[model samples]
Target: MNFIESELLRIFVGEQEKLHHRPLYELLVSEALERGMAGATVFRGLLSFGLRHKVHTSKIFELAGELPMVIEIVDITEKIEEFLPVVEALLRDSGAQSLVTREAVRQWTT
Candidate 1:
């Protein structure tokens, strides 16, 4: 068993205009990075759908296209908290409906 100290924040989002796709997530991730967050990760799901109910999954090369993504970041709790305002603003700016979840750190490791 591996043990590490970290805080986790999850930003779950739905589909929107293409312009808002990665940039919004990027902005938040960048802010975290700038603040010296331990690490941040953006995950583009292979087969996923969102509030639109349009079944973003596909059988071809575009399988990952238009799919909802889960933007996750991990760092110290204080750092993550500091970036909350900007993160909230990004969510508002993108007009993206999202679920924000956080939990105390026990053990997190890859």
Candidate 2:
């Protein structure tokens, strides 16, 4: 069995101002990858709400507006640790929070 030791970094940030969620997430992932991080991805919640009383969830068919987005990146301990500072700076600049970072013991890949 193959194994990977890494940290799973999950960052939840608000969708506000001119900073679009998808683009921001892509940028973050790209930046991390460029720094030699394993990989990163962004996940958009269909119906979700977050800080600043921003409500992206709605029953109507029409799209409301900005929604909470999560950027997940997994990499080795050294790499993830190196990325933490950068991630923090980005989050601070964007005024976003709810960052959850933890060490992952195993990775199951086919």
Q: What range of 10 consecutive residues in model 2 has the weakest lDDT sum? A: 14-23
Candidate 1 off by > 4 Å: 1-5, 14-22, 60-64, 106-110
Score residue 17 of candidate 2 by CA lDDT.
23
**Could you tell me which residue pairs clash in candidate 1?**
none
lDDT of 1 by residue, 1-110 (tens): 67666678988764342234465667777877887877778876667655666666645555555666678888777877887887887788777668788876745566
Note the Cα lDDT for every prediction shown: 0.71, 0.69
Per-residue accuracy of model 2 over 51-72 as CA lDDT, tens digit each: 5555566454454446656788
Off by over 4 Å in 2: 17-22, 51-55, 58-63, 103-105
Among all candidates shown, the one with the greatest TM-score: 2
Model 1: how far is 90 from its true place, Å? 0.9
Q: What are the C-alpha RMSDs, in order, of all predicted structures?
A: 3.6, 3.3
